[model samples]
Target: MITLTLVGIGSGNPEHLTLQAVRALNDADLILIPEKGKAKDELAQVRREICANVLTSDVHIQGFDLPIRNEAITDYDARVNDWHDRIAVIWKQQIDAHLPDGGKVAFLVWGDPSLYDSTLRIADRIQANMPLDVKVIPGITSIQTLTAAHAIPVNTINGPFVVTTGRRLRDEGLPAGIENVIVMLDGECSFTGLNPDGLHIYWTAYAGMEGEINLSGPLSEITDEIIATRKAAREDRGWVMDIYMLVRSTP
Candidate 1:
């Protein structure tokens, strides 16, 4: 039986690895790190650094080129599904080639697997091809890290919030009657599209890491600053993983 573990290593911070995550990495027969091309090479390098920092034992680590999503498909859902299918094929091929005898293999996921990440879905695709059992080790989410960085609470007293994506915010707008919002995977800084009345924003780039950049203020006043800071962060680091929380009339 092949046991596949998805270990969340937290948001680009090697020290964020839990003791369980460390043990899982060291115990794996093989670990696969996906290279997202030169534009996002730092992402792959961060994974390697995590392994180097933890693994007390000799563990096999391999790098694979992740397949790009087919943009020509013209449909968002179809393109993403097709891309995932292609990625599953690559993952199976890599696993079979490296650990043919059927042993434990692991993949390091950024943030908790239960969140917005698609790694769990991709793993479901792999399971259909062969006998496998999946295990997840949770790590600190950027949402948690973001709130921690600002020393602010995620929710107002007895109030609910929505955790959403940049695409959704752009397409659907904010949820009705929701006072607190945490937005992730937003390349466009989507909040600028909404009414900034009474909205206070807590924003952070590289939320959990030592080199994080944080910004906060009335959304109306700081919208331009946030956009400029975002551009600079991505330009300087070659990539940006950021999240922001919005509170309307905070307590």
Candidate 2:
């Protein structure tokens, strides 16, 4: 049986590894790392760093090129489904080449797998063809890291909150009947499209890493500053991973 472990490594920080994640790392027969081209080499580097720091026992580290999704396809769900199929093929090919006998293979997922991550979906695709046993190791999420960086609670006392993707927030606007929203998977700063009136925004890029950037306050007041800083950081590093929380300021 193929033992597939989807381990959450947290927000690209070596220190974010929990004791359980460390143990999972040590027990893996092979670890898969995705290389996102030259533009996002840091992602693969971070995965390697996590293995270097956490794995004392010798474990096979396998790096594979990540399949880039075609955003040109207008149908969002269709595009994602096609992408997942491609990724699963790559996963199976890598595992088969490295572990022809189907031993334990692990993937380091950013944040928790239960969140807005496609790793689980991709794994499921592979399992349809191969006999597989899957396990998820939870880790601190980007939402938690963003809130902690701002030193603010994710929601008001007894207030409702929602977690969503950047595309939804931009397309749907602030969701109905929710005071707090945590936005992720946003390549562009979608907040620029919203009406900033009475809105409080807390933004963090590289949420839990050494070079984290944070900006908060009335959206109108700090929007420009956050955008400028985010641009600079992304240019400096060749890529950036960011998340933000917004709340309609209340009396």
Candidate 3:
């Protein structure tokens, strides 16, 4: 049986890597890094830097091109499922070619795999084709980094918060009774559509990295600033990952 370990490398900072993540890196027989092309090459580069810093054992490292999801398909679920299927095939081919007899293989995942990441789903697809044992190592999430960078609590005292994606936030708007909403995977600034009177936003892009940017204020006052800053950051870096928390005051 092949031991498939998914190690969460945390956000962009190498210091964000936990002791367990470092140990996992040293123990892997082979580590697979996904290349997301030139546009996002820094992401893959960060993983390499982490390995270089922590890896003492001589382990084989391989880089594979991450398959791009088809945007032509109108059905979101169908598009994602098809993309995951293709990724699984590529993963299997790499494993077979490198370790024909089966051994411990690991993949470095950004943030925790359980949160908004499809690595677990894609791994399930791989299990259907081969004997596999999956293990997950959790790391600091973007929400954690965002909150820490902004020096604010995620939820108010004796209150709750909802974590959701950009698409859901846009389609559903802010949930009716919830005071705190953490939005991720939001390429579009969905907060602009909400009634910004009583809402405060804490936004961060590239949290924990050297070039991290943060902005927080009443949503009404900074919505345009956030949009312009986000656009400029994306243009300068070739890609951008951001998360924001919205807190609406209780009447």
Question: Best-fitting candidate, measured by TM-score?
Answer: 3
What is the full ranking by TM-score, best candidate first? 3, 1, 2
Q: For residues 1-251, could you state the per-residue lDDT of candidate 3 as single tens digits?
A: 78999998888899999999899888989999998766458888988988999999999999999889899988999999999999999999999999899899999988899999989999999999899999999999999999999888888889989999899988999988999999999998988778899998999999877699999998988999999999999999888899999999722
What local distance difference test score does each model get? 0.89, 0.90, 0.91
- Evaluate model 2: give its lDDT: 0.90
Q: For model 2, what is the alpha-carbon lDDT of residue 91?
A: 95
* Model 2: residues with Cα > 4 Å off, grouped in runs: none
For model 2, the run of ten residues with the poorest summed lDDT: 35-44
Runs of candidate 1 with Cα error greater than 4 angstroms are: none
Cα distance off (Å), candidate 1, residue 13: 1.5
lDDT at position 172, candidate 2: 96
lDDT of 2 by residue, 70-175 (tens): 8998898999898999999999999889989878999999888999998999999998999989999999999989999989999889998999988998899999
lDDT of model number 3: 0.91
CA RMSD, predictions in order:
1.2, 1.3, 1.4
Clashing pairs in 2: none
lDDT, residue 179, model 1? 87
Model 1: per-residue lDDT, tens digit, 177-205?
99899999898899999899888999999
